[model samples]
Target: MKILDKYLLKTFLITFTTVFVILFFIFILQTVWLFISELAGKDLDLILVIKFLLFSMPRIIPLVLPLSVLLASIMTFGNLAENYEFAAMKSSGISLQRAMRILIIFICVLSLVAFWFANSVIPYAEYKFINFRKNIAQAKPAMAIAEGQFSDVGFYNIKVNKKSGENGNILTGVTIHEKPNNYGENKTVIKAKDGKLISSEKSSILKLELNNGYYYQDVTPKKYEDRSKLPFVKSAFKKHVINIDLSELNKVDTDQESVASTNGMLNVSELRYTLDSLNKNIDNEILSFSENINQRVGITRTMRAVKPEQKKKPLPNNLLSLFKKNKEKLELIKTASSNITSTIYSIDTTQKDLKEKQRDINKHYLALYEKFVIAFACFLMFFIGAPLGAIIRKGGLGLPIVFAVLIFITFHFINTFGKRLSQEGGMTPFMGAWMSSFILSPLAILLTYRATNDNGLINFDAITTPIYNLFQKISKRFLPSQNPQ
Candidate 1:
């Protein structure tokens, strides 16, 4: 490599690394804050928390890497332009395009690396992260119960007005409603002033100790003779103990392969296969429904036993005979009307289902295209940031950071809006996925062109010059006496 290429690459790499680390940590902290309530007061081990954060890194890296590239490119090129290194290079016969050659190649390679991570590492991490969260949720059954909300715990639904104590196990003003079993016809209700949950790691039972409670049992009569009177039982107790089975809650699936399929957890090949299968199913359903509707309407079946040409001669010549004939046909018309209504309703329902399935297919397609689109965005962002830095001729965290954030926000907003539109069938999946790229790529090219020619970041004079001259002319005509001096 030439000395200039080496120097540019070195500076760009240093900035990229620093920016990547800072953005990654920022995103991770944001993720932690989002899940703080679920993680806190769960008596979870520190190692488990660390593992959760580690599993989350793969998902966060994809979002961070592009922004890092943008900021680093802007800051690196900005510094070069600010310090006159770019001018020196230009004077030495190295054009802006020539200077960017090595870095562009580097960014292309980085884009491929980003794609590899999205295609491989991200899917695995997404699957593991989802299952790990489920495991954590199952491990802390008591934590799932929040204050002032009813939560199902085994056969009972329990609600608490207040939860205060270590590990949030102590409950106040508890209300428990026991669901009826197969043989029972009535529900049992229990209200307690306070309660405490006690469980051990190795035990399969969670025991609830209640104080100052009343239990009410409803008894319904079995025989008709006793139906006139309703019976119930009420009992008051200072303390009550309820044991809940925790065997199911403690069971975590060890096989990661058994995790349910999600769009975010599938690679391109899997998504394609799913999309194809869904489309085939939808087509077959539509065909079958059409045939069913045809048969229901008797379009393909003969309603009369005799052939149309072999039927007897018509006999409805008088009013009485015509009335009798019409009466017999009325039943047939009613049956046909009912069948048509039902068929229309069935077709409407099936069409709705087909639409939902199509939306799911669109989601899969969007996800597949998103991986490649975001990878390409890294390259696009560099083109934008590098030239923008040269044009602005400023360096450091202040201006560059602000510009990068604004550009990225616009890109992200367009991408999100397009995805929503595609998911709702308002736009094609490919177009929706590539909308941001299409919008930004031209801006990048324009900035690169302007920067290469030594033009200002924006040509404000071209627009403002005409307006200012027009204002001066209007002022002179309106105030001629004052302008004479």
Candidate 2:
């Protein structure tokens, strides 16, 4: 029994890891290809690009690892079923639940690792990646160009034919090929007679000045004779400054109101702050609305009672009439004053509302923190995989791969949809992210039971047949009444 268990576990681990690597590479390559064109003229070093991609890996791994586990498990189990290994195990008195007990333990450990990766490692990697890019953007001007190299300046590809040191900066004969504009196929090439590079550490600006340069405008010629000569462009001094905002380039903010490191990752403190601010704002708006309503009512009453003629009357006479006729107005003024006091009270209540909201948000964060159980999904894959193997009774890649893909697709879709909704404040982040796996736990158990008992996969055909028939009947009933023939 021990030998058999070791063999199955080994096979599962090998296949799972191989497939996961393949999928990871494919995703990484796709991302790199999509962004390569944008980096064409930019002085992005190969080493830096590689480092950036490496740093980004931690962020994506947490997302992909679970699916990889699902796929690997399904395939592994499907293979076991095909080979009758599960049947043999059953014959030897090893229950499906007993076999899966080991996997459950494994899952628990993996879950903890995933939790740490998401809440700590990934966020730190993201922070460093952003800062590195910002530093690259603000690096020295001379470092921007390499001799006999084609470098990108924003959207333009520039090459320098010759270089010499002049006035604390590099001087060169420059060739710039600007990328296509909205109106043209491609930009005209510019050959500068001479150019100078300037850099300042205090300001994130690289200055390039060119002298005695002629330009050719690339546009569709309207007349036949107009195409006779290229547009004569002469410039005495052409200076360009590439302004880079180092601060905006990086997403992390290090300031008084900036999120602290303890609250930096998907942690409780930041969420609490956001929730508290929103609740306070809502309370303030509610109070302001009440104040506005009272003010409006008071002004309306005052307007109705007071007249132009009354205002022009003798002061005593006006005062007497005001007393007689404007008693309602006076009462409204008093009521409004009371409402204003209530508004003040509401302002005081805002702190309490904020605290309550902070507490609620912290509850969610704490819930996620405590229930780090979801991290074990990697190991849970084995339970789903091993039993699925016995049930399918298929071995090689074909059937296992298909089953794995179907299960993974479903899981991925659920997880992603939930994450997006949660991030947009529609759902609790912890619940949204883990809901799919939580729901699937029962299904895995059921599948394992059926497989262990030698019962076949559920008869979906019979279940669907009735539903399809009902749908057909409903459609027929709803159809527009045909002419009685």
Candidate 3:
């Protein structure tokens, strides 16, 4: 690399790293705030918390990277411009376009890296983070039942007056209150002298066994609606078991819906597969309906020719009754055919709805694909940034950074709006995600040319100001009247 190119890269790298660290720290702080609830009253080590944060970092890194790059470029070029190093470079034989080639190359590399991280690393991190949370939640019940505090686990609200550090295996002075499920069944509340949490050696059951307990239960199930008091029975027991299913502790994968089957989430391939499956189901349903209709038509024809006169031949009473039963059978078949037709229509409507849902899933993957593609903006920024710096006769972090940030923010906002439109099914997937980039490409080229020729930054703020003013005036005119109405 030439001296100029090497110098530009060094400035870019330094700025990028500094911004990345700050952003990463901010993300970590946000996470700590979010998960503080889960970490309460537990002897959770720092290593475990750090591991969770690290696992989460990749998932959010894609979002942060683009902004970081934008900031780095803006600051790097802005400083260079402020220092007038760009002027010195221009005074030499180094042209603006020549100087930008190195920056462009650097951006290309960054874009590729961003793409890899977003598509692969981020998805895997999301999966792990979800599982980690589930594992923690599974252990929450034990952690929740602290000494001298009321704890609610599942359906039971219980309190323990005191607990010893002896393996945390036993509690004393236990009081329990249980509420019936939604089905109006009676609830049993138990008061015990002590309780212990135990697990079977070979099974996945978590058992809360209480000792020396008197259980109180309402026997009358129907008396919940009436205000009349119902008598309760008190039974003494030496031990009682509250068994819990451990399988409920597993992390729930949202994509494990029936439509998804085995595919973890609705990726591009999964969306396509689901669409095909819905189509096949619809076809099969139609074919089944057709066969049923044909059978009904055959039954109707067979019954039509069953002549009453021909049936005068001597026949056993059972046989004659059997012939008579054909009429009712035919009528039943006709009713069934009508019901099937109605059902077929309903299925058709349902299939259409499923197709719409599948389309929505497709829209999401399309957006994801497009967002990854926008990482190529890393490359584009270099094109715009490098040339602007050279033409403005600057090489420092000051002016280049400001210009880069403005360009990136404008493009970023446009990209976001387009994606939302796509997700809402307002715009075609390609158009919504890619159109902003396409529209800006030519504009970026123009800006690069002007900057290379020392024409200064192209200010489109005039055009935007008018649109903003128009919205402001419209809001002022209409917003106030609607409030009273």
Expressed as tens digits, the lDDT of each residue in 82-193 for candidate 1 is 9999999999999999999999999999999999999999999999888787677667775656678787677888899988887778999999989877835336899999
What are the per-residue Cα lDDT tens digits for candidate 2 across 1-485?
A: 47656676677678768878988997788767755533444555787777768766775675578767776777776666667766787788988777666556656677777777766676667566555543553353444454565765555666877656642245567777677757344446677777777665565555677766656546545443344454444343465433433333233332212323332344435546665665677677667766665674455556667987877645564434555557777876666566665556545666565555554554445334423534656655556766777777776668877877777677778767776666555767677757677877877788877776777787787899999999999988998758888
Per-model TM-score versus the true fold: 0.76, 0.55, 0.56
Tell me the lDDT of candidate 2.
0.62
lDDT of 3: 0.66
**Descending-TM-score candidate ranking:** 1, 3, 2
lDDT of each: 0.86, 0.62, 0.66
Model 2's C-alpha root-mean-square deviation from the true structure amounts to 15.3
Best by lDDT: 1
Model 1 poorest ten-residue lDDT run: 221-230
Candidate 3 has its poorest 10 consecutive residues by lDDT at 255-264
Per-residue lDDT, model 3, residue 273, is 70
Candidate 1 backbone overlaps, count: 0
